[model samples]
Target: MPSLITPVMPPGSLNASAQPTLTIDDLLVRPWLGSDAAAVARVFQEPMIQYWHLRKADSEDEAREWIEQWRLGWESESACHWAVVNADDDRLLGRVSLQSIIMVGGQAEISYWTAPESRGKGVCSRAVARVSSWALNEAGFNRIELSHSTTNIASCRIAEKTGFALEGTRRRALLHADGWHDMHLHARIGEA
Candidate 1:
């Protein structure tokens, strides 16, 4: 798929005061669950997710705990974590979430991971666009933010494609095992 660019949304349609139904390329976006640990986990193991997240996580139990923790955030109303499942097969294809909500400003950050077999196919781009459009038009979110390491070009492409403008870079914001890495910051706001 071609890289995405910033697209102007309808005026007044994308605001923190409204919420739209978001549909991502026939993939149902639903809340994450412990039951989805196994399916959700397959994406975690992908070379891309592993590199971005910077963890190997060799066992299913370990991955389940991680999901459980994310689930806690959901339970506490601290985030919106979701599992992306194929509409036809209902098989979990990956996950996308609005995490670490900055409630004071009516903004939040989004994170997503796609199945290894599903990468380079525009699934991430579609999901981000679909959810971001909903977040702006229906959910009343003011801004959606994203950050990725410099080396992760694929993710950068995703952000750019989804209409998020690259703001700047956070110097050595992430301390990975290999070393510290910079985070490229990107953001998208409602149509003005």
Candidate 2:
């Protein structure tokens, strides 16, 4: 049996080329590097990051392991993660990722977080919008989805800013540290 829509992108398509660096204003979005472990670990230590993400890198080694997973995801065409950096000083600012990729279906889920210092400055939203556009227009994906806990008003605003339409909510879709959360589902689809 075949899917009604043929594979929009073949497996290994993303792996075939060097990941390109994307830009938004003064920031650059590039593939994660092993050397970024120290900065990544430091960011993971931030209380807000730990609270929202539910995981922390207590050591640089753990951060490196996470980086390695991103590398492997590229090789396997399962995900794409980029580190957002300050163009002038090369300071780490945040991250944007397309995970749970399904090439045959041309879809993926968007994930993102901004460094505490970069929050409230539109970094995450701009980075997410840029990455989502790239994924749809250049990376061969037709649909990209963003979901966040319903209580996360900031994320909801980002989704709206990035033009991801509210598709509805999934009750108790995610388990957080405190309890299960109903998640708001948003999606952006490329023009057919």
Candidate 3:
């Protein structure tokens, strides 16, 4: 594993406003909006999303709570979240987030999900790569980590393609609806 090093910028430099709209190919990764609640509720219905994330919001009101949590995370400087939208029509495709942030240590964990219709199209991978690049190069994060259930081959592929080196596995680290699952840990270091 690469050592966690502090970035040049001081902690708290990355606030909500510091986040920018990032365009990668046809996808637009931007901050989440209150109006996105309905769409978010719909996406959370996906079996795969529900299985991994371990939560579901079937109503707009329930979904708004999720968005509110993301917003609060930004205000607290504890995390950053983005809505993956279609650049042309501004349709929500999925979400990408840098959670578990330790700004003083210049480190964060990456998480993402693709809409059911958007899967197998590399949407998640592209969004993840772009966001991770920005976190390392622009936001000045020294280390980024990704973790997924060991059974999720697709997520493993995304992590590998985005330059995150597989570190090891944490047995029974996450509890899904089925049971406790072992999770693989991956990490990437910023350029020197």
Candidate 4:
């Protein structure tokens, strides 16, 4: 089947040598590396991460596969995933992704997670804000959407802190291990 999604950036804009590395406060958002598998597996073991993301990498090999999938997403122009790391020590904090991109419509969905050790430090919030700005101003997207299970109060706070306005709720929109969840939608749009 022909692909429906178009590239967010023009051809050659995201070549290997030109991939972006965004710095936000003390965080560095960059492409994932093979050496990050161990840290990725460790983060996946966190209960909150497992609960929301609903996937885990039990071994470094599995984590590598996950990284490979993100790489493929970039190649296919379907998504852009960044490893959120501490700029001071280059420690992996978590991940933030722009997925469900509709280049023709200049829209995409943002998703993110915080590492167990990085929680409560505002890492995710800063990362989201920086990325959202880049998506709007640099990536040329007009609107970015975020959604979280209504039970995820922490995520709701991050969305609000990052300037995403509350949109509405979708009944039974997501199926987690605990069953269907009501999802709250939020969005950030570019200036007129």
Candidate 2 per-residue lDDT, tens place, 1-192, comes to 766766989877799998879988899999999999999999999988887797899899999999999878888899999999998888999999999999988999999999999999989988999999999998889999999999999999999999999999999898889999999999999989
Q: Residue 8's C-alpha lDDT in candidate 3? A: 58
Full-model lDDT, candidate 4? 0.88
Any residue pairs clashing in model 3, and if so which?
A: none
Candidate 2 has what TM-score? Answer: 0.96
- How many backbone collisions does model 3 have? 0
For each candidate, give its TM-score against the true structure.
0.81, 0.96, 0.93, 0.91
Can you give the lDDT of residue 34 in candidate 4?
Answer: 89
Each model's lDDT comes to 0.74, 0.93, 0.91, 0.88
Q: Cα deviation of 129 in candidate 2 (Å)?
A: 0.7
Which tens-of-lDDT digit does each residue in 1-192 have in candidate 1? 653643232233323232223466677776666777777566666776776787766767887888787766644545666677777777877778888775546578998888888777787888888788877786667799988888889989999999999999999999887799999999999866
- In model 2, the Cα lDDT at residue 56 comes to 91
| Ordered list by lDDT, greatest first | 2, 3, 4, 1
Task: Give the residue spans of candidate 1 off by over 4 A.
Answer: 1-22
Number of colliding residue pairs in each model: 12, 0, 0, 0
Residue-by-residue lDDT tens digits, candidate 4, 152-174:
99999999999999999999999
Residue ranges of candidate 2 with Cα displaced over 4 Å:
1-5
Of 2 and 3, the candidate ranking higher by lDDT: 2
Q: What TM value does model 4 have?
A: 0.91
